[model samples]
Target: MNTSHQTATVSSKDGATPPAPRTRRRRNVAVVAALTGILGAMGTLVYFAVPLYQLFCQVTGFGGTTQVAAKAPGAVPGRVVTVRFDTNVARDMPWQFSPPAPVEVRLGEERLVAFAAQNTGNEPMLGTATFNVTPFKVARYFNKIECFCFTEQLLMPGERKEFPVTFFVDPAIADDPNAGDVTAITLSYTFYNKGAAALDEYLNRSRATAGRAVPREMNQ
Candidate 1:
């Protein structure tokens, strides 16, 4: 061999270092394990996404889910807010659902509202109601002490029932920056066939589990 070629050859003891095959294999295994963990976590999230999202909305009033209260803090002395109502019956429900007319309510004052429902079908049917408020952000301050929507109703043919909703605008709404300019809120409800809205009924169970009050937001 030529002298120049011999000098060009590098050995580990002379500071020439090569990558370790074992080290490379260990790195690959670590990367695969990390990737697998990440994918598994994402899959788990996808599976629980729906119930979790609804639970989140119910707690935060996001998506117009209103607050549930045991009683109204005394209505703001002279403050009044206009509340309008809307109602709907799902297709093929065979029921007539109507909400009360717009009414002026004093902040912190308890008010009783009623909705009329009649079963026109030939057979008795069970229905449940889903409700929301608009200007959706105002939902948190709209408190319902008691509402028929909280339970399922069974109506027999030709039976007419009046559903009661007892509620109030939390006096704190007047103090909230987000609700400062809110002069009116429309409460809406849609009656659905119990089987078609089995998912929505979960909110009721969650409410019961959460008890009298639910925090507005959650980290999870």
Candidate 2:
């Protein structure tokens, strides 16, 4: 009887259960939570990053804006008129502008205008420009087919470059009562320097050394 009792006590002690199953469940839950959090963060980043970057580029002129360069096909031909080109850079930007010699073109024929931009300051300046027809109404008939302002320009100090724009007035304008009477159109350019964040410190230092005031138009 004593031996049987001792045997029974030893059996009970050896039967102590381990917590292996519970531990495994807790570890699995933790891993799943971690994965969920990481995926959520990645998704959130993707959602906001692209659009924010695009908006920043547009406002800062890091990426050039879309502009129409050519007139619509099949426009009516009208009397030739002389057009003028004007360019304005920010005051802080050290640059020079030269207007193209005026030329006469018929209403439907394409005309090309040229301008010379020179970096007068000591530092390299990088900027983008956009062109528009003044008086807004004339824009309907004035068409530009090729323009350098469509892209960003990197000008080294003392560098001079001639940019050309080819454009024409839509012949159709001659038929429209609102546009038919218009004889002259003005093409204007507004330029801005890329923000410091988009430009490197070396370039920024160059711009500062140049010590030019920001241009009035770029203040907008």
Candidate 3:
């Protein structure tokens, strides 16, 4: 009887030990599976992050996109006239701006107006611009055929660069009776730093505060 009891206890202990190994094996497998899943997710995210960001940029115009400004309610196209270009920097910004002495063209003709942008600031400035027409209402009639504002300008201290823009007024505006008598159109430009990180932060902050996404292609 003593032998039989001892034999039964040993058998129970042995059975318990086997189960422990199986449990350990299952735990190990689970750990490996979890780790694999995490790594795969990370790899997928890394692969798609850049392209997703670019798509976001294209859709939001975060960089810049062509846009038409506000137009006069009753504006009609008039005789094709040359629209002039000019630029100005804030007092703190040591920059120089010069547009063509006399930018001229017929109403429907596209002309490239050139400007000399000089960085007079002591520090290097990354320049990006947002432009709008002086008379907001004429934007519908005034069209930019080519513009440098679509790209960023990296200016070193004391750097001078020539920026040009090709634009025209819609001749159809002259014929539109609703368009009020429009004489001169002025295109205005505002410059900002083109640093992507800074721009992203600024935009994000603006969106948070305003509760609206800032137009990415606003100035361009």
Candidate 4:
């Protein structure tokens, strides 16, 4: 006599019931929906990159973004702070920018400093500057009364101009325990060309559609 045995395939080795076809279908749909949502959020992220970065810096005084003020309150005795200057020009800017040499000032003492720029290119160009201060924690106390940054600067070929900034360190900085060790700050500016003739339109629309193209929940 010959004996034969067959091994049967079960849904699971442990004998747990398999999910029904409908249940499996629902899981597949959920997985696809999650992937779709993630892809959509990635697309929206690029749109918010630039403006969001600037806003974050400005709000938290991160990245050394400085503040604007009308004038210094008054000079504080025995509170002299060293302020260094730095300048940079974008490769395509075709302009020269050199901040004045470093200077020392008493807290709350209003001081005027000039940053000069000259067009080195043979053609007219429009350039603007972006500035920040370091240590970033001191940015709140570093106020600028006049600045050339963030403005449409038009220069004819070989044209030279002097832009000045009236600024001061607020005496209140002395009261902040976190800033007690801050004795110096460096103010730096970088100039770049945003193209010609469209400066106004570019700036006007830079933040115009900030929230329009992005959904409220995508960032969350």
Please tell me which predicted candidate would have the highest TM-score against the true structure.
4
| lDDT tens digits, residue span 1-220, model 3 | 9999998899898885435878889999999999999999999999999998778776676866535433323323445454666676655566787767656555666666777888886776667777888677777777776677746676778999988776767767666766657677788776666665754665567568666434544545
Residue 123 accuracy (lDDT) in model 1: 73
The C-alpha stretches of model 4 lying farther than 4 A from their native spots are: 1-67, 197-220
- Cα lDDT tens digits for candidate 1, 117-151: 99998876778889999999999888888787747
Q: Write the per-residue lDDT of candidate 2 for residues 15-43, one digit (tens) a residue.
A: 96544988989999999999999999999
Sort by TM-score, best first: 4, 1, 2, 3
Q: How many backbone clashes does candidate 4 have?
A: 0
> Distance (Å) between predicted and true CA of 166, model 2?
0.8
* TM-score of structure candidate 1: 0.58
Q: Output the TM-score of candidate 4.
A: 0.60
Q: What is the TM-score of each candidate against the true structure?
A: 0.58, 0.56, 0.51, 0.60
| Cα-based lDDT for every prediction | 0.85, 0.76, 0.70, 0.85
Worst 10 residues of 3 by lDDT: 68-77
Q: Rate residue 6 of model 4 by lDDT.
A: 22
Evaluated at residue 20, the lDDT of candidate 1 is 96
- Clash pairs (backbone) in predicted model 4: none
Q: Candidates 2 and 4: which is better by lDDT? A: 4
